[model samples]
Target: MEEWTIEINRSATKKEKPNTDQLEFGRVFTDHMFIMDYSVPLGWHDARIIPYQPFSIDPSAMTFHYGQSVFEGLKAYYTPEGNIQLFRPEKNMQRLNRSNDRLCIPPIDEAFVLQAIKQLVYLDKDWIPTAEGTSLYIRPFIISTEPFIGVAPSHQYRLIVILSPVGAYYKEGINPVKIAVENQYVRTVKGGTGEAKTGGNYAASLKAQELCSQKGFTQVLWLDGVEKKYIEEVGSMNVFFKINGKVYTPALNGSILEGVTRNSVIQLLQHWNVPVIEERISMEVLYQAYLDGSLEEAFGTGTAAVISPIGQLSWEDKDLYINDGKTGKISRDLYNTLTRIQYGKEKDPFGWIDIVNEANAVKQ
Candidate 1:
């Protein structure tokens, strides 16, 4: 619907590409980034792709003071056919608008933004890794740029998109991880910014995450703030538990960010005739199920780590092991299936892959 201007980064030279086998997550970035400015009466303008560089922002920027910002994470896969594709990117754009509504920011044109992303991805197509379990990570974010110190929302905002080449989320490749349930530190309560992909929610979890990491846990398992009984989510992904031959996940009870991969996992489960239930699940109940030896599989789903199996969970000094502390059969199956479809190695029956580089995919 709208056009995005392309500006090649002159005087830019490609660096030695990292060995995909040794690439860590989100450490290296591509040569270019997409940026747009937003101001009242003028709306969002000056959409362009430029060399990736630091932003010039005042110290009193609202995003820094009041934490008024939101971001989304997605990935581009280099298919076997030499094609690059994005999986369910529209969902990320829609979620961005939802986050904007919650943060008192202006909504963006989803179609236009998607086109801009396609153009950016196209420009950096060479940076898309083709190694096994490697991909180009896409981070799209909006920040309040108005250099004012006040309690109200900032008037000026900036939307930016940057790309990074990443290796497998887990160095061991689909290995199960350990998680510790957080009881003292709460992530967020209902009717809070928990549902929104804002910075504060993540910033708040850092301390707890640090504590958990010190205890050798991979990530902190968050609980709802109000009750602290119902399971909310993991720090980086929506979690799912398979017990007694059924799949159960913490519903979006106004406190969990709806994950695109989580939804895809659910859909895939249903399509494969596996039962899935979305509802409140307390840690006590889950532990009880574990005691009864019914907890079959536990995994967290996110864009970064598509499916992270939870081998062991520590709650209140008690450890509950899932599937003998190894990746479960279902977890392995889902990971293989989802990743196959992602890399275009198999036929996409869900119609989720969107090819970039297609004519009319992005307007000039």
Candidate 2:
């Protein structure tokens, strides 16, 4: 195994940290960031921590035209005991490599990069918010930096990690939200890049999202591209529906992004002896269930909101109000349990918490 060492470069002038209570999602960033470079023969090299300032990339960079990139989102929480910890960060690292495979980017050393993330978070520990529903959002992304216009994959890449103190992902917090079902625009197909956590997948969603947002919807509920019948995703999160007494979410169908929070919610449901199923769930079936009063609740799960209750889902001028347009029991419970575990208020039986040792902080 090759030894990977990250060189440290502290920022001379630190930026003002935002007020925790007034924090919004991804608006305010911390002082330092982690970066690494990769090329054909060198693999990944020049790992370092430096000031959070933008560096110039060539105007004709491949990433600008070819859109070859991948990214991951996770967070660090401030425990009541004055310690900082991450919630299942290894899963994010593994997912990043999976995205890399889809994008034809070089694989990164997951363990080493995870260490660098912890060190970077710990180095800026003061930026970790203590307010409820607040956390230090961590973003790890890779961009094709080779300044070439050809269609082939780039020979060079840059991986960078930046931190932001964020509040609730949705303005509603843990409350239920209204979503618009999209039938015209497709997110991705089974054999396409939908499963990859790349910028193109999100870029594909912007049009529908914008249209839905104009109609007073919080997010857009996407249907599968091939048929436009089965449920795929809800904006950026994986969706679930509770009918009768069992919970069902769309299975990993290669076109749907596998979400870390979605997996955790499934595990938690299983742990609680709740029946949760992963299968093809169609909007017609869901609407019929709602008509028969069997569709009890609906929610979307992701690292951002953890769990966003679906108050109402509108499709073809019909509004399916879930749980009377209020937060459902299951949704509230999952949010509370997951968040408690994240903030270190509840016992972590799943061994998901990774503690960041403050003692490892590099001196300025």
Candidate 3:
């Protein structure tokens, strides 16, 4: 692993830290950003931390014209001892590289990316809200910069990381969310970039998401492109089901995004002796489970909400109620456990939190 050299952007100063009380998710940003340029010949170089500002891309830039871009989302938390840490960031790095592979984007060393994020977080530590359920949302993205009209991978690329102070994902409350099962539009198909965290997948889901909001649903529960009967995942998170006291999630189909929160929740459930089953769960089976009183709970996992419990799922004509339209016992337990570990309120038995204080965790 190569060490990242810090280039402090002293040009910016701390502004009024947004009222930790009224923070919004991914709306307000911090002071500085970390960026690097990539070229086929030079690879990733010219890394620096600079003031947060807009960039001027060529009208013909590949990313602008052809949509050759990918991104990842993760968070930084402030521990009780005033220390900063990232939760399972290695998983996010690995997922970003996986998305890179599928998009023909160059692979990045996880060590390098991790170091960059750590440096950025330490520099912008004040942006991390101390309020419970608030975090410093980190967005790492790669964009093709080759100014060409041709349809192909850009020889030149740019990777940038930005920080945002985010409050609780559910502004109204943690009340369970309603979801609309999308049977008409498919999120991803076999051998497609559905598994990748590319911009196009998100762009494709905008219409569906709009439709969801219009229909009084929080998000769209995406299904497989071919069968449409098999549940894949939610819009931006992985879906989970609990039937007959056993937890079940859709197996990693080629069309689903493997979320870090999804992985962490599964590991935590296993540690707590909860029965977790990953298999190809069909919509019909889930409805049957609900009818038979075997379906106990359902939720979506992601960085934003950690775990968002689903109250009800409505397909075109049918509606399935989950656990009296409230947060289930297992869902509450997992959320509390994860948040406790994050805020340093609970001992980290899984070695998941990466403490970032060199003076404490390491000797300078």
Candidate 4:
């Protein structure tokens, strides 16, 4: 067994902190960031926390050409007691490794990397926003650095983690918004990289998102790639539909990205005995349910937005208004419960909170 130690390089000067009230999603960054490099024999080495500045990379980096990259998004919150905490961060690391497997990137020591994240966040703890509906967004990403033009995986990689103060992922916040069902551009298929948290997956979604945004939609609800009828996910989150008092979300069938918030929502619903089912749900079935007045609520769940209520879903030019274009009871309750637990306002019955201690942050 080898010990994975991280080096610390404090920034000489601190950056100006953004106003809590004016914070937007991923716009303002912290003063420091974490970086680690990987090569053939050295593996992942030279883990360090340095100033948040850009470093030069080869123009032919494989990440830019072949797209061998993976990333994960999580958050750090300020509890009411003034303690810094994270919600289910271990799950994010686990998912990152899973994505690494899909993208042929080398595995990382999840526990060690998690410690690095804690240290980095703790070092910049003052940047965390205490205002309502605000937290520190964490992005952990790995990019292939080997400047190769071939279509194969690179031998060298770089893992970096940066922190951002974010207010809300959607302008609508927790309020309900309109979504358009994408019938033209499919997101991914069962055997594709759809399940991986890679740049390519998100890159593929931009086209559909652009089209939907032009039509005054907040996001596009994607269908499966093959037949293009089964519901896949929202552009940035996993979607759920409540029909006849039962909550149904698209099953994880190698095509949908397994969302941490989606899983949490499912567990919370089950804990409340709300009859949550994960199965293949087609848009036709959902539309039929809406026509029959059984579709009670619809929402998208992810780390970015936490929970986004879908008040209107447009499919084939037919508009379906859910809960009378208002946030439903379940959506409201879930958002409140999740956010409360995150901010330490409510009890964490699931043991999902991980506290960050400044003393245990860095080890030489």
Candidate 5:
């Protein structure tokens, strides 16, 4: 592994770790963070893991004005034994670079960044809550730091990684949730930045999310921006549908995010010889399946909720109830298998787990 200078915090704050049972999503943070800088000629340099603290960037930073930023989310799990692990971390780094390319930010060394992430997680391993439903959340992001007001891409940027302890996604196992199909507000268009994991894409989704929440729905199911007929994705996840013994999901049509969990589910299904296909599935087609009683199960895949069973979908004052408003058998099986693999409770046939060892992360 390439070397990164480590600066241990003198006054460590691990003793103040929050209670595991009371942990919420992204509400609590760990003690240390990793940072690196990038510029026109310097490229990426000065990698260090220092005490977690707020940055003092200038007010005119390009990220604030032009929103030249990108981010990725994954988790570090504490296994049954005393080791920590990551799930498909390399995929996240690769996706980060994809987003960087779209946003005009400088690309990062994925190998070095993965090593840095393992180091940071090991240093703060005490913050990895051992509760069954709790684990350390890893958030890696990059932002433009040039203090110039320009419409073009900034010349300088900062790559930062932070950790948080998130509680269980559900009180019990994964529970079903209701979603509102968004018809009025569109998420992104083809040939746009929708596929990239950028800030502006999420910023544009807040209004629709708020509107859907006001209607007693947990999240909004977005439609294609141009046609408003084909299904795109959920607000924070990629969707899947099981109908008549075959599984269907919206294809990656340049507008939907290519999610790690989504890919994993498709692979797992194929491994088990289950029928799954990726195509441009429209709402009308899915509703027709529901009308004919072929839509058997529905779930959304992402990092946060590994598998979210969608109980109902509301569209234009009409509701389509799925699986009798309860968690389906396939959704339950997927949630169990994925979570088991993630927590190291099952055999890792996919080589998805990255075991953390302190000896490899520390500098000589």
Candidate 6:
């Protein structure tokens, strides 16, 4: 394995780490970060560990106009034995490659990126919150930075990884969220960049998300663009339903974001012998099932919150309540079990946790 040279920045403040109890999501960042640049001739090079600071880029950078950017979110949890563990990081690495492929970006070696991430996490180990519902949120992104106004792909790019301490997503417990079934705005089409974690796809959803919020909905449940009948995904998550005591989610129809939490949840459900069916779930059928009480629960899965229980779904003039407006048994179980394993409270039968040793915790 190739190792990048390290350059330590001791200029960061030695102030006390923020109280995990009061930590806010995405608000508090770590002291140091990792960055690497890629040019057509040199490839990915000059990777370094540096102080968290903004970069100097030309005003005409390719990303400024074309929005050629991609990102991934994942977390590192501090275990009971004073070790930091990453949850299924390889999946995130693979997905990053997928996003790069779709965005016409060159794919980095998975092993190299993984190693770099591990090193970054180790350097900012103090930023890993230790509270029950707290963890270190890692954001890895690559952007086209070539100073050009052309409409084509840039030959230069920069990749950076930053870390932040975040508290529980729902401070008021795992409160159920309400969703608005959006039949008006389309999130992605059959051959769109929806499957890629690109910036454009998220920018496209902001309008609908704003509208959903203005209408008193927490998130917009997007539907298929062509027919707008089949359920696609939620704002930043993959939707799931519990019908007749079984878990059901929409299949990856090349339009849904394949989330890490979604994959973990599926694995957990199957491990527990719970029935989880992945198929094309139509909006009409989902609503009818909810009306008939077959849809006992609804939830969204993502890296940010892990799993968020959806209380109700509003579409057109009809509203459907899910499991008495509370977190269902399955949702609670999955959340608790996943968090347990993440926090080192439960056994990791699947070996998904990559525990970082203390010697390897700090950047060398």
TM-score of each: 0.96, 0.98, 0.96, 0.98, 0.97, 0.96
> Could you tally the backbone clashes for each prediction?
0, 0, 0, 0, 0, 0
Worst 10 residues of 5 by lDDT: 6-15
| lDDT, candidate 6, 287-360, per-residue tens | 88987879998999998888899998998999988888999899999899999898899999998998766555
TM-score of 6: 0.96
Best-fitting candidate, measured by lDDT?
2
Q: Whose lDDT is higher: candidate 3's or candidate 5's?
A: 5
Which sections of candidate 1 miss by over 4 Å? 2-11, 358-364
lDDT of all the models against the reference?
Answer: 0.90, 0.93, 0.86, 0.92, 0.91, 0.88
For model 2, which pairs clash? none
- Which digits, one per residue and each the tens of the lDDT, describe model 3 over residues 1-364? 7765546565345766789888977878888788998898888888888878798888888998888889999888998789898898898899899998888889887888888788777777878998877889999999999989899888999999999999877666567999999977777798899989999998989989998899899999998899899999887999999888889999887888888888888898899888999999999999999999999999999888888999999977999889989999988888888888887889999999997765321111
lDDT of 4 at 86: 95
lDDT for 99 (candidate 1): 95
**Any idea how many clashes model 1 has?**
0
Q: Where does candidate 3 clash, by residue pair?
A: none
Q: Report the CA-based lDDT of candidate 1 relative to the real structure.
A: 0.90
Task: Give the 10-residue window scoring lowest on summed lDDT in candidate 4.
Answer: 166-175
Clashing residue pairs for model 1: none
**TM-score of candidate 1 against the unseen true structure:** 0.96
TM-score comparison, 1 vs 5, better candidate: 5
TM-score of 2: 0.98
Two-way TM-score contest, 3 vs 6, winner:
6
For model 3 the TM-score comes to 0.96
Model 6, stretches more than 4 Å misplaced? 1-7, 10-12, 359-364
**Candidate 4 global lDDT:** 0.92
